[model samples]
Target: MSLLAQLKILVVDDTTTSRLLLRDALETIGFRNISVAANGEEAMKMMTTSPCHFIISDMNMPKMDGLQLLKAVRTHKVFARTPFMILTGNADRNVLEEGRKLGLNNYLNKPFTPEDLKKALEAVVGRLQ
Candidate 1:
């Protein structure tokens, strides 16, 4: 199999629509090993049980937000080096700042097209071919 097909990816978002959109976009870009979580708390659980190479999460969610999840991931030695990108509609600088402090790899605002998603992913983890 191609490397992209085995590159495990996690998509965390509160809204089902956003999660589906991201999953679809990732699939369109040739990623097959993708998983989804509704909130950061759930995402964390998924992360520990089934580790991912890349994480694409939203900034805001119930129980735990993206930054919290990022903090958790970064603080933990196992997932500390994993590539993390926040795909959020939130424009709050404070939130983004927190994410940066927590070692966010990259971020992309919502309402994004598949091309935009590809570029964002490329920016985070190099070209995905």
Candidate 2:
């Protein structure tokens, strides 16, 4: 099987609809193993037990937010180099800059298409078939 098909990804979003949308987008991109967390705090807990290969998180979630999650992930020895991406509606450069400082691999603006998602993933982890 292709690596993309087996890549384990965690989708962290506060809203149920957003989580479902992101998960479906990942499935459409040929990723089979996906998990969802309602907030960054929950995502952190899940990461400890499940150990995903990647994390795609929303920036505005409560209970730890995306940047907090990114910092936490980067500080962890196990997930320090794991691919991390943020999904944000805000176009503020400060947010992206902050993510960069925190070792973010890539990020995508909200309401993106599957093609955009593929490109973002490729930018982070290389070309996806």
lDDT by residue for model 2 (1-129), tens:
787977899999999999999888888988889999999999999988889999999999877989999999999897788899999998579988999999989999999998999999988788887
State the lDDT at 115 in candidate 2: 90
Q: Estimate each model's TM-score.
A: 0.94, 0.96
Model 1, residue pairs in steric clash? none
Sequence-dependent TM-score of model 1:
0.94
lDDT of 1 by residue, 35-76 (tens): 999999898889889899999999878898888899999988
In model 2, where do residues sit more than 4 Å from their true spots? none
Which candidate ranks first by lDDT, i.e. highest? 2
